[model samples]
Target: MFRYLILIMILSITLAGCTEQVKVDMQGAGETIPTGSTGIAFDGKDLLVAKEGLIAFIDNIDTATAGSIYGYEGHFYFDRYPITITSKENKPYITGLAWQNTAGNTGFIWASDEANRRILKISPQGDVITRIPLTKIYPEDITFDGEYLWVVDSKRKKIFKLSTEDGSIVSEYLSPVPVPTALAWDGKNLIVGGLKNLNNPAPSPDNVQIIKLDPVSGNVMENVETSRYLTSPAGMVWINGKLWISDRNSGKIVIISDKGEPSTDIRSYKLPAVAPVLKKVEAKEDKNKTAQDVDEAKRAAEEARKAAEEAKKAAEAAKKAFELQQKK
Candidate 1:
C-alpha cells in the first residue's frame, strides 16, 4: 500500500510539471540602415537623427506605416540635410536625442552631450535654448513622455526622470537590464532596451528583452522584444504607433510594431543608423536583488494584471453604453 501511494505521488508530480505554462518567446524582424548614429526623434514634422557631432533631419521617408510582417523596405528613399554643431571647446558627442512636438516647441530638441556631461536644448535650425549640466551621470538615450524627460544612465544602469525646465533629477530607478541601452515612451509606459543576454536568452515575458516600466514608481512591467533582428538596442522613439529603435554599432535603425497597429500587421522599420549611444558615468557595480526584491516584483506583476483587467472591463462597459444609446 505504501509503494502504491509513492507511485501515485510521482505520477501526480509528473502531470503537474507537464501542465505548467512556459513563456512563449516571440520577436519581430526587420532590415536596417548602417548610419552609425544612435539617436532618433521626431520634431513635429521631420525625423531628427544625430551622432558624434552632426545631426541630420530626415524631412521625408518612405517610412513603413502598415504591414503584418516585418518590412523589407529595400527600395526606400529619404531626404537628409545635415546640420553641423561646431564650438571652440570640442565637437559634441551626442549620445541621445528627444523631442515631443508640443505647443510652442516646433523645432527644438533635447540632446545628450556625452563629452561635457550635459544635456543641450537646441533645434535643427541651430538655435540654443539652454544647457543643463550633469554633475556625474552619463546620459544615454532620452525620450520626452509629453511632460518630463526620461534619461538613461548606462554607467549606473539606471533610468532617471529629469525636469525639462532645469534638468533636475526628479526620480531614478534601477534598470531591469544589466547592460541598459535605449528608452522610449509608448503612450502609457516606458520601454527600455538592453544588450542581448545569451545566458538568459529571454526577457521576463520572453524574446529580445526590451522592458516596459511604470512611469510613476519606476517599477518594471512586461515589454516587447526585438527578436534577433536588432544588434544594439541603442536609440528608440515612438512614431505612428511603432517603436523605432537604433542599433548603434551596426548603424541600423530597427522599427518594432506596437500599439498603434493591429497585432495582425505589426511592424517596425530598419533604416539608416542615425543615433549615437548611451554614455556611461562613474558608478559602483550593480548588486544582486534579495528575496524581498523578488517579492516586490511579484506584487508589481499582480497589480499590473489587475490593472489590465480593470481597463478591459472599462472598455467593454463603454462599448455597451454606446450600443444601448444607439438602440434608444
Candidate 2:
C-alpha cells in the first residue's frame, strides 16, 4: 500500500507539472503595420513606411492610419501643394529612402527602387531629379551619412555610397556575407542586420546577428549579439539612440537599446477558439453543515471561479476585437 501511494503521488506531481502554463506579458499590444512592409524611417515626429509600390508618410506614429499620407503620393514634402514625380519611365519598387540637404534651396531624398534596379534622386516636393541605374546588383536598404547616401545591395552583398547631389557611386564595399536587410547609421558606424541562408532546406534560426561596418571602408568593425527571439527583421531605425526593428513573420516590433539588449514591445493578434459554456461549480455540498462554514466555502469558491471565468472571457473579447479591427 505504501509503494502504491508513493507511485500515485509521483504521477500526480508529473501531471501537475504537465498542466502548467507559460505566460508572456507584452508591453505594447495591438500595434502593428501591414504585412510585406519592409523599410521604416522616422522624420522627427512622423514615420515614413515603404511597402510594395507605395511610400506613405504617417503623421502620427503612435496612432498609425493605414494607407494615409500627409503629403501627396510619390511626393516628399509635408507642406504646400503635392508634387508628383515621374519615375523616369522606370516603375521600380522603392525599397529604402534617405533625406539630405544638397544646397541651401534644394533638399534631396534618395530612394532605392529594387524592382527597376536603380537609385532615384527626388526633390523635396517629389520631382524626379535623376535616376542612377545599377547593374548586377539589387539595392535593399539605404541611409545617409554626413556626405553620401549608403545603399545596401542584398544580392551582391555590397554597400555602395552614392552622391546626394547626383546619383553617382562614390565608393563600393563588399559585405562579408549575403542577405543584408536593414541599415542604421550611428553617427560613427553603420549597423547591418538580416542574415539568411536561402539554400538551406531547414528553417533558419530566429536570432539575427547585428554587424557594425566601417562606413568608409565597408569592413566589419564589430558584431553585436541580438536576441534569439526575432525571426526575420525587415526594417530597422534608430530613434533616440535605440534601435527599433520590425519582425516580418511575427508582425511585431522589437526595441533594442544601444547596448544590444532586445525587448518585444508589440504583439500580434490571435483569434480565440470556440468553447461550450458550462455552469458555475458550487461549493456548498453539505446542507447539514454550519451556516457560517457553508457561507465561507461558497464565497471562496465563487470568487475563484469568477476570477477564472473573467480572465477567459477577457481573452476571448480581445480576440474578437482584434478580428473586427482587422476587417476594417
TM-score of 2: 0.56
lDDT of 1 by residue, 57-168 (tens): 6644444323437543432223455666656666678878888575676546888877778888886576777889889588889888888998888788778888888887
- Candidate 1: which stretches are off by over 4 Å? 1-34, 63-80, 196-208, 259-328
- How much is 80 displaced in model 2, in angstroms? 12
Q: Write the per-residue lDDT of candidate 2 for residues 95-116, one digit (tens) a residue.
A: 7766664556455666778878
TM-score of 1: 0.61
Task: Highest lDDT: give the candidate number.
Answer: 1
Lowest lDDT sum, 10 consecutive residues, model 2, at 71-80
Angstrom error of the Cα, residue 294, model 2: value is 99
> TM-score for all predictions?
0.61, 0.56
Error of 2 at 181 (Å): 1.9
